[model samples]
Target: MIDKAKLSALAHAVIDTEIEAVKALHERINDDFMQACEFMLHCQGRVVVIGMGKSGHIGSKLAATLASTGTPAFFVHPGEASHGDLGMITDKDVVLALSNSGETSEILTILPLIKRLGIPFIAMTGRPESTLATCATAHIDVSVANEACPLGLAPTSSTTAALVMGDALAVALLETRGFTVEDFARSHPGGLLGRRLLLRVSDIMHTGDAIPTIDEEALISQALIEMSNKGLGMTAVVDDQYHILGVFTDGDLRRVLSQEINIHTEKLSAFMTRECKTGRADMLAAEALELMQRYKINALLIENEHQQLCGAINMHDLLRAGVV
Candidate 1:
């Protein structure tokens, strides 16, 4: 039977080897790296990435990262490119080819066509003196000293090195393009970051009759009825023009009840908290949550551009919308 300690040691060795491989990539970010970035940055069309096997998987991830971070890019298999998928590339685009050995026949097969089209080619290979590196417009070396695999055959450390290098290139280009979180969010609209950045108060607030509201002249009992009906635990006190005068919340009601105030006879204007925090219809839900947390309040009255009360939101609304 195999020793359990040996298995654990082997796992640790693999992790340590991969970590060192990634660290070695830091020194390889030379002029070639900058030249590659310049080529992609100036490309009028999309970046077409091509690779084979494990390199293809890494290339696919690299393409996605580039596309999401302000650089538009996509992956095409090297094998596919050899057939008819080469047509997907254009003169205006830049080609990024990946091959650890630097002589992937499928990638080499398309090199002549790329040269004829006068399109810029950026090659990422483990061999700096390889044919692909020599023929390309720019070359990024992702050579690794050894493989984490004990047999020295399976792509372990070398693939990890290439992946880290790809990430480094993507992030470098992202910084050069001055890409922001908002820009990244636009490309990932279905994600949580997109929801936090793009979701506005108008998108999710309780509008129309859903807003719990009462006139300033309404009795505390009437305000309670509106709050109960709206299920917001709070009611907005507004004037004839729907201008928010204050907010009456369950906390305020409790304070009033502690003073022996009669709900049927006390007007909301007399018991409501005059200094109410308000939000705008155009504000982000994340900003609204910050406002709620800062004031230790559960509800916020939303106003339109004209400064008129238009909507309202409570903690529960934000929570239900997954904005909290």
Candidate 2:
């Protein structure tokens, strides 16, 4: 069997090599990088990224990062492009090609057409003197001193350098475009931050007949039925005007059990927690979650400016809405 020490040493060496490769990308962020950004920013169309094999994998991830961060971009396989996918490219789009050797036949096949369209071409290659690099409107050198693979065959450290350089390009463009959290949220509506920022109490709270509410004078038995039927673990106690007065929860019931109170005779007002914490209809669900967590409570009544209970939301509601 291979010795453990040799395996550990190899792993550490690979990591150290890739780290240095990524760090070297910082030095190449110069005039050519700025020109590539200008091309994409002024294109008025999507940034089309193309590559092959390992380079394709890196290009795919970079394309997604660029799209989500405010730049519109997508990945098209170089081989597929030669087989008709090249039609996806348009005169309005800026093409960014990736090839470690700068001589990938599939990319070269389409290079002339890319130039014929008179669109901007950005190349990321390890060989600065390569045809792809020389033909590019702006060339980004992602050359590495050595591969992380001991055989120097696998595109390890070289691919890492390209990946980091792509990220640098995307971030520089994102900052220049003034991208904001809200802008990112809009693009990722199903993500946690998006839901936390976009969803409000009014959107997910139980309203009308769905709200678990009882009159302040209602018997504890009636409140228990409301809580059980609504399954919110609590019932809001409101006056005749529907103005919230307090809330009786499962905890309150457990506390009253010690006093041996009569459910049929005792009123909710006698056991309810008065002036309970409340939230506004316009409050973000994330904010409601904070309120619940801060007070160690599980439910909250949503009200308007007049303090009238308009809706009810529980921890389960936030969970169902993916805000938890």
Top-TM-score structure, candidate number: 2
* C-alpha lDDT values of all predictions: 0.91, 0.93
Tens digits of lDDT, candidate 1, 244-322: 8899999999998999989999888888998899999989999999999998999999998777799999998888888
Model 2: CA > 4 A from native: none
TM-score for each of the candidates: 0.92, 0.95
lDDT of 1 at 73: 97
Show model 1 residue runs off by greater than 4 Å: 256-262
Candidate 2 minimal-lDDT segment of 10 residues: 20-29
Sliding window of 10 residues with minimal summed lDDT for model 1:
315-324
**Residue-wise lDDT of candidate 2 within 1-324, one digit each (tens)?**
879999999999999999989888878988999899999888788999999999999999999999999999999998898889989999999999999999999999999999998999999999999999999999999999999999999999999898999999899989999999989999999999999988999999999999898998899999999999999999999889999889999999999889999999998888999969999999899999999999999999998898899999999999999998
